[model samples]
Target: MAATFNGRLFLKNTAYLTSTGFKVILAYSRTTNFFYAYYVLRTLTAMICEGSINCLALAYVADNVLERQRTSAFGILSGIATAAFVCGTLAARFLSTALTFQVAALVSMLAAVYMRIFLEESLPNGENLTQPILKSGQDDHCQDGDLSRKAPVLKKIPSIQDIIGLLKSRVTFSQAAVVAFFNSLAEGGMQASIMYYLKARFHFSKNHYADLMLLLGIAGMASQLVFMPLLAPHVAEEKLLAIGLLGGIADALLYSVAWSNWVPYATTIFAVFIVCVPPCLRSIASKQVGPTEQGKAQGCISGIISFANIISPLIFSPLTALFLSEDAPFHFPGFSILCIGFVTMIAFFQSVLMRGPPPVSSHKISCNSLVA
Candidate 1:
């Protein structure tokens, strides 16, 4: 809804402030039931907000950035998020849990306040940020002018048909969506399977997971921040996407057959290349969309990713558990991880074949009008 009608900057900042405030309140809540209640409220609020700060920020990038630099900009944004993971891990290591949560909330609140005060709306000049964008379609069922005028109204929610229409409207958009799905599937499956596989094989603990995460996070940050921008224009995002998928395949393969405890940690360097997948995929998606519908297009891509994330655990978790147990099955402990690699392999091939001419947005019909 914020994507279609409201000011994205304002909505994102407000959502951040509200969510962080809820986290702060939850941190201080006295009752056990209230803790769960706080979480439930937060989830509901998230649903209402339609998307996260990350997706909204991506939409903002699509709005403000030029085509040639979009991929690099997305890489920078991704790098910052990776840096957050590194920072969060370090903070949790040093700070007490209560202090950490409070500090995180304070930082979030200040950032939100700062954005709300200073950030300009990602709308064209003269477009009111606080006002909703609406179009009055003629009512077919009403013949009277007054009734026709009264019945015409646009909904402020995303529609399934519009998303389908957008996908159908451009082959590139659809290809980008598929790339997002498979890449997310591979990443989510790896994340779900690797920890348990390591725990079973090498007897790793929470600290080991933290160390692994730190390595992955730092690698991702450096590659996206330092290397990606330099490579984006020359290589192009499509080639970058293929490169990331290839890296994912290699990472998964290594994890599946890891010989020693150090193998997993040492191989975390693969994240430096793997992190290119998302930014490149999103950069490709943004180019398939027009300036006005950047958020809507990004929303569709995000929905695909969210759906893949939901399905990934369902597919990989059972596979991991079954292979790890002493059940009558194959002896390969990293079978699930190998399957994850196959997922990336599929994405890699698809990305290699992912070719489309640039979308002609100037004459493109608006998909939102069909269902908005």
Candidate 2:
């Protein structure tokens, strides 16, 4: 809610400030003769606010949902978010930026109200949510601590040592973390450049971008809702991860080299497979640890993704700006995008090294049923 409110205010302020010729000096780079000012201010106003929610939501699903059913649950979650994105994009097409943001703020406020009123706490009465940070078998010595009692206050904020311990303890966890980092890096780099590339190459307007996103959202929704549930149970998550990475690599390559407007639309075929990546990775990561460790595991994955978000723009944005400029040394305008595809290939190779978790069995009988 705060993000939405702040975003709306920022948009309004930016318009007013720009119209009034107001600019703040962020930096004066001597090498490029660049005046990096207003854009930096604009970026600061729009913060990444979804990290905590994503971590908490995935952790909750991991804790409560049956292991065998987690992929479908996560897929459904992704589908719902995609549907919401479609709706939001469509709405934004017709609405002014300020009004659109205002509406978003209002929607977020309502969502907060609803969650507060209806959402139930997932943790059990005696379970200390904070205790799991240290109790998740990451450290053999930590396990010696009393499980019946709450964790020490210091344990709530996980130390660097705790994270290092997790990374060292589980090979699967480490592999999943690598897959997530490179996957997110590729995604972020693509997002940072794609819109600008489209606008520069095809002279795309807002409606054109909206149409593209709509198609992607529909493809993603179909894959998550229909294909994922059917395929996840039968296919190994590791193989699915590899397939998704391969699809992403192709998608990025296609976008980078697209000569005609229709080529971008054609890449929607790859979206179906690409959308499967996150759920597969999440399912694999979730299986790497016991129930007590779900939060920590998912939190680590989310943290890696956040780091990718930071690193991606730094690497891709300047590359994109350089390649798109008339002063570019190379004639290939798609060089930056090709780099993104290559980054995705790195992730594909990482996925290739992963061993799938053993198949789960649902045929075992409970003790009460065995007695009967």
lDDT digits (tens) for residues 222-261 of candidate 1: 9999999999989868888988889999999999999999
What TM-scores do the predictions have? 0.87, 0.76
Q: lDDT per residue, candidate 2, 42-104, as tens digits?
A: 454334333546555666676567767778888888888898998998898888755675566
* Best by the TM-score measure: 1
Task: Pull out the clashing pairs in model 1.
Answer: none
lDDT of 1 at 270: 88
Model 2, poorest ten-residue lDDT window?
Answer: 1-10
Each candidate structure's count of clashing pairs: 0, 0
lDDT of each: 0.77, 0.70
Looking at model 1, report the run of 10 residues with the lowest lDDT sum. Answer: 125-134
